[model samples]
Target: MTTALVPPLAACAPVGVFDSGVGGLSVLLEIRCQLPAERLIYVADSGHAPYGDKPPAYVQARAEHILAQLRRAGCKAVVVACNTVTGLSIQALRERHPDWPIVAIEPAVKPAVALTRSGIVGVLATRNTVASPGLARLIAAHAAGVRVLPQACPGWVERVERGELDGPETEAAVAQQVRPLLAVGADVLVLGCTHYPFLRPVIERVAGPSVIVLDPAPAVARELARRLAQAGLAAPGPAPGDVAFWTSGDLAQTQRVIALLWGQAVQPQRLPDDPA
Candidate 1:
């Protein structure tokens, strides 16, 4: 019989970040920028890319599985960097691990509501996030009487997953979703999905110079910093921490795209097969 060794949990343990795909790299970048001292462990569940279009139950299951893997890595805290999962599963996850420091992302609706000059804000997100009741509740809470248009960007996540940041087809797809919102006088566009940030230039070109695009990753990072301090899980440091990558997708392909998005080369390991 083989005994498995588990990493010891401590304030210095690496923070775990999970996303449906490379989109979560956007959030990871923010966390890295904000908390340079903390070691980071990131998982891109790319085999299940674009959780935005998946059913809530399916996304919830995948989220649970990935979180289990992160916990097994002995993460001090976990960040659900995928907005779709945050929308669909965050509450359940928090309930399941009440004492764990889990930070989740949501659309920047409150900020969009405040920033919209035309009182019309456009939210570009995954289908699942747009359809989730949590988004509706969020709009109701912060966007009262404001025209908060929820635009479900179907192909955006896949485009980013394939490392297609800019191209005619990508532009067309982004324009197809962005124009209508602009036509309707939405002066502020909120990137509700982490992957959407990679498409910001295209989105901005379609939206024109007058529009404001908001990414919530920076804010999420700040919130994470606060949470870690509150929980006394902040890493003590003078040295910059390193990042480890894992994926449940093709290792070579995942590594390539991650290098493209992350602006450097990184070798990503394949996730272990599910236990029997």
Candidate 2:
């Protein structure tokens, strides 16, 4: 009989996180808040900025590429912090890397259903994420009888990635996309994409005070913490862990956005398309 080998806890490396752009920083921020002693490696595949419109195969390929890079960088676990990518590629990733701890983001429909007073919840996400059968099943299982409105803000992610939060164009886009949901009496809105949290102010303004917007960052952070603890991979605390960032797009622009979002200077390393 063949014996299965076990990996030691010390061999489990830093947590790896990826997104199509800076939006994943929202999730990173949350993770840092919850697990201050755990090191993190974040990658922004900004060259492929909006994965929502891309084919499933393309998203999967990009995700696989990034995961390989993270593994090479000594990451023992990964988080698919983007909803579109998570929706399309997480299952395949888990299948391929069965030993690695993986956490993924999904729309907060269950929580929205639980919190809504009007029985109508709105989800603002990419077409790819909203259209996924996984999302449909989640709604069917956890939110039966509750009205779930999914709105795909096609250009919203692009605008947010460019650090354009509040302008005439952004305001107009937010208002246009949210009007129909509000019309249908949606009192709770889910910021379904990791990137969408950065646009919270605009979304709130468009949806009005009567509506509540929930960002899944806090929950994602909590889950990451739980997974690390369960796997005996949680880092001990005394000093804070280091955070390193990489991007496949313009390094300067990516650094600028990171600094803006993180409220500190960020010098992100630029990685090649095939960095091995």
Number of the top TM-score candidate = 1
Clashing pairs in 1: none
How many angstroms is residue 88 displaced in model 1 relative to the true structure, after the best TM-score fit? 0.9
What lDDT tens digits, residue by residue, belong to model 1 across residues 181-200?
99999999999999999999
Query: RMSD in Å for candidate 1, one decimal?
Result: 3.3
lDDT for each candidate structure:
0.89, 0.86
Q: How close is every model to the real structure, measured as TM-score?
A: 0.95, 0.94
Error of 2 at 53 (Å): 0.7
